[model samples]
Target: MNIEKRVAELVDEKIAEINRPDVFLVSAKLHSNGKLIILIDGDKGVGIDECVQISRYVGFKLEEEDVIKTAYNLEVSSPGIDTPLVQPRQYTKNIGRNLSIKMADGSKREGTLRDATEDAVIIEEKIKEKGKKAEIVESTIPLEQISETKVLISFK
Candidate 1:
């Protein structure tokens, strides 16, 4: 099999062996320069210790199985806050947080995420007219219509 697929399988195996049901593999990529990047996420959040544990386990397994005969660097970590939401679980975990969404039709929306499911997400937003008080509005967006979604960080 291909190197990236093999690495992903090893990561899945390690997660199962360690019984980390909360943790899930986001992606595994073997770059051209022999860099193996593994991104993992959790229902809550992934810690540095979890990343180190997975990194070590996957690295050792790769060596033991001789998956990559040449020298390769292994890195395992959580997708950072700036990364876009790619999974339904990720959206569920970020309930009540602000999200900036880009639609497939080139529209954009920013609001507080109220609910999320397999099919769609509900967001609460505010609408203001020229001379009227702001009105609260909630919208349901289908998952298929969303091109990207990023959790908005407030420094306030």
Candidate 2:
């Protein structure tokens, strides 16, 4: 199997042993330089201790299996806030947060996430018209129509 696939399997095994269903594997990659990068996320959030425990578990498993004979590096961590949301569960957790979505047709929409269903998400946006009071409009966007969605962080 390819390195990436093998690493993914190892990650899955370790996560299963950890017994935290909320903690899930986002992505795993094995670099040509013998570096393994694993991204994990949780419904609430991933802590540094969780990352360290997973890293130790996977690292020990790999070493015992002789997966890497030479010096190798392993890193397990959460996908940062700047990372785009990929899973439906991820969207569900972000309800009430602002999101910037780029549609497949290249249009962009910024709104506060109101709700998420299996196939779509409801975003509430404020619209203002000339000589009219501003009102809130909710748009339901199918997940298929969105090319990318990123959580927007506001200082205020």
Candidate 3:
């Protein structure tokens, strides 16, 4: 079995044991030189304490099981704000945030994420016309047609 898959399985088991069903595994990668990276997400957001807890638990389990005979480094954390939204839950959690989305047709749109469903996301975009007041228009884009969606951070 793949090392990353096995690590994910162990992490899932530990997460269940801790009664943190809200936490879900986002990605797991076991790189050369014995570096294991695991990204997790929560319904709301992930906290550093939660990540540390999961990391300690997973590290202990892996060591106890002798999964890695050699020395290894484990890092568990959330996929930060800069990461693109890949899961439906991620879209739902990001409601009301600005998002820059790239469509499969190579078109891009920037808007406030209003709502998200299993099949599509509704975004409220402002339309600016020359010498005219800005108009807010809501558009729904199917998930299948979206190439990528990243949350836009505003310092203001």
Candidate 4:
């Protein structure tokens, strides 16, 4: 009885019932303290109303099925901006945004995400020579080589 996995399936069923193609599940985790956390996201974004709807629907289904015999707290929300991107759709939606990527080999890269594909991502990196002007170069990184990628926030 993998509670986390079961919760994820229930959330997916609710998402299908709601018919919001843009909205998708990011993660469903059940902590040792009886806390069930569900993270959802959308291609554009997710609103509080959508989170509420998912929470209500999933909570109802969980109660009806007696999935968790013990008392538990259910929390449903979107992953924060600081959270690293986990899904291909997340990367696709973030095209044109700057990203700070950490490679699996322990190197790091910062660039503007130009495009995202099933197997790789193209990013525009700024190359600077000590005495020369900065040059923009496009780099292609395979998805398997990336360990984590976070969207960079710009003030201007």
Best by lDDT: 4
lDDT per residue, candidate 3, 4-105, as tens digits? 888889889878887888888888888888889999999977888878888998888887888877777899999988998888888998899999999999
Which residue pairs of candidate 4 clash? none
Clash number for candidate 4: 0
- What are the C-alpha RMSDs, in order, of all predicted structures? 2.0, 2.5, 2.5, 1.6
Whichever of 3 and 4 has more TM-score, that candidate is 4
lDDT of 1: 0.90
Q: List candidate 4 stretches off by more than 4 Å.
A: 129-133
Worst 10 residues of 3 by lDDT: 63-72
TM per candidate: 0.87, 0.82, 0.83, 0.91
lDDT per model vs. reference: 0.90, 0.87, 0.90, 0.92
* Clash count, one per candidate: 0, 0, 0, 0
Per-residue lDDT of 1-156 in model 2, one digit per residue for the tens? 466677778777877888887888788887788788888888888889779988998888788888776787898989888999887878998999999999999999999999998889999998789999989999999999999999999999
lDDT preference between candidates 2 and 3, better one: 3
Model 2: weakest 10-residue lDDT segment is: 1-10
Candidate 3 overall Cα lDDT vs. reference? Answer: 0.90
Question: Residue pairs in steric clash, candidate 1?
Answer: none
Model 4 C-alpha RMSD vs. true structure (Å) is: 1.6
lDDT of 1 by residue, 2-96 (tens): 87888888888878888888999888888889888899999978899888888998888788889897888898999999999988889999999
Candidate with the larger TM-score of 1 and 4: 4
Task: Name the lDDT value of residue 107 in candidate 2.
Answer: 95
